[model samples]
Target: MLPQFFPPFADAVSLPESPASSSLGKALELLDLFSLTSPLVRIDDVIARFGFPRSTAYRYLKELCDAGLLAPASGGAYSLGPRVIEFERLLELTDPLYRAGQQVLQEIGDPGAVYLLHNLYRDKVLCIYKQGPDVIEYEGRRITVRRARGLPFPLFQGAGSLALLPWLSPHRIRQTYLRNAAEIASSGLGDDWEAFRRVLAAIRRKGYSTSQGTITPFLGGIAVPVLLPEDRKLVGSLAWTVAAGAMTEERVESCAEHLTRAAQAIAREYVKVAADM
Candidate 1:
């Protein structure tokens, strides 16, 4: 029999008690515990976190191992498995935004700047692609582009997140505003829904958004949304980041112009590709 594939972070309590469903739930839960800061996990760590019995944890881990979702490492540790590499490869192959965004970045984005393509997933801005300079300094440590992908930013924060706000329906906008009112207020956008709506209106009129040190401390960004031409639906955002000190008015305007152009090109390509498909 073929092994059942488990969706990422599936809720265990929601699934019916078929053997595959039961096993898949536990496997997904196990995988959810892995993250950039904690990439490797031991059975004891899982036990400590989830309070699962040793045998039960081992069973779940073994199932994931057999399914190629987790691989054993030294000292009884397990890291994310080769299947993740395959899944990312499949994502790049299947996702239109990645290809179209790459083209947009190459054409309009500054070669030395940091550019990110973000999509709204589960109400958060997920960084699906990142293009960075040869050395990017984050919190005084230099990192590469390969290390920056897949990082998620909060939906109600950052220039990229603000760029997407105007595209949401009024009801969703109000809901999101209410859910994140305090944070939004703290960020100086608004203290209430009315103020927030005004801010979004201004962003829509300008065709882009800019923020200083909102997502990453000491960094600023300018972002524009990619909208589908036919239905005007929001697909994602294209954003460029620079050091906070370098975000002069002229530089911000220039970045916004570049971002807007790239966003328009990406949207056109995305719609064309979708129509062809």
Candidate 2:
């Protein structure tokens, strides 16, 4: 079960995440057209998806390629470009959550575990920092700390995602429940509002969360949320995962103890970082 805090993922909910309102937003949404299966977006794909006129499609493509947010690929397609990597590098050098959580993880490094930090970002839980093998092969399937680094993920599953839920504000929680009831139900967090609250309440009362391969196969994780004491808001989560083959109940309790303490230190550092801003 998850906690009942008002939804605590990233920026405040600005509803209706579709039909990019500005030229810039529309152009950026074009980037969303590219994915693993469609790694190279062609002009027709953008026009078909966004319904942009032919001339506007070409212009947008040219502008994106020129700006290095996209690069022309073989067969008249475009792929995300070097600027994306540069931006990722820049964020790592400066994002406060990543900075604080990663330093703390270094202090508690374990060869057999994967340390992770996740936070809300525009209605999704994003793994902001990960210290582990890039991919773990389990049951002939390849999985990583996330589907892909830098990709946004739905908040309905995973230890990192579930752990942060209890610290959200009540209104946010209700709003999230309303908007994502189906997903919430499917996730087994609850099938109804009261049930959802009760489930999350149980997680909250426990002071941490655990998942048995809910988000990944053959791995179990224990997670603790990071709350800025002065702000009284849950901002993110810290978690560590261990392969089920090697996991034991004792390890879960010990990891919870270690993560709880690390989360506190990271929260304190977070306050310092916020102050400097």
Candidate 3:
């Protein structure tokens, strides 16, 4: 479940309705409904959420299932299908950041730690890849590293997301701050724009950001921004997550150092590849 401090993924923005009229558009909309928190959705739920006529909703669902974009599950529900897996594999193969991240993860050589690669897309922070230990026990329940690839988060919330903020132009930062003021305050990052700017300035000075239980309780995160030297553009961020109980000051400092080093390595490789292309 998403913590109350975090907003629902669907509510990130209000999508324009111009595309809703087309069959292809509606099909894509159906796909958008599947998210980490609500993976399995029922036909009735679709009807209720979208207010589509029963017949029309079923037709769209049928089309998606037929095309392997969605698949039937037990109890008359549906989940994303095999084709989605194919697309994800293709993305990993094609995305340079993912390739660089794989190398960085291998170099880090910590199989017990969780690492994530994130990039900015359409003004949102998108998790591109996740690696490390598959599961960990938390509060007596086994928590698997949830599949986060392609999951989007607000750009100003978590440490990984905020790592990119320092590189944004002051105008863009101000705009984002005003737009998400309530959420920013609710997140405990800041209660006002000045406070928020100070937080980002601190990250800029230290070259990394750290937080405890900001995104998810009992999970501590540290992140460093990936910036290419030639253009001085922010590429993305490298982040590590660990159980809060294990987050000593020494551990946090070590994680920050590792992430900063990995970020530098990824930036160099990424810049070289982009130049060659």
Please name the candidate that would achieve the greatest lDDT relative to the true structure: 2
Ranking by lDDT: 2, 3, 1
Q: What are the TM-scores, per candidate, against the unseen true structure?
A: 0.73, 0.81, 0.71
RMSD of each: 9.3, 4.7, 7.1
Off by over 4 Å in 1: 1-29, 47-63, 132-147, 169-182, 192-195
Candidate 2 Cα misplacement greater than 4 A, ranges: 1-19, 133-152, 245-250, 274-277
What are the runs in model 3 whose C-alpha is more than 4 Å off? 1-27, 53-67, 72-77, 120-126, 134-157, 169-175, 216-218, 242-254, 273-277
Pairs with backbone N, CA or C atoms under 3 Å apart (clashes), candidate 1: none
Residue-level lDDT of model 2, residues 1-277, one tens digit each, is: 3432533444555545455788888888898787768888988998899899999999988888889999988888889999999998988877788888878777766665677888896558888887777666666766665533465667878788889887787766867786898999999998887788888888888888988777777777789999887876788988877666546778888888988998999988887776786
Q: Taking the candidates one at a time, how many backbone clashes does each contain?
A: 0, 8, 0
Per-residue lDDT over 176-252 for candidate 3, one digit per residue giving the tens place of the 0 to 100 score: 77577898888776897567766767678788887776677667788999888677787788888887777788988
What is residue 72's positional error in candidate 1, in angstroms? 3.0
Candidate 1 lDDT over 83-188, as tens digits, reads 9899999878767888788767777646678888988864578888888674657558654333156877777788888888787765566556656778888877
Candidate 2 residue pairs in backbone clash:
2-200, 3-200, 5-166, 5-168, 6-168, 6-169, 7-173, 10-120
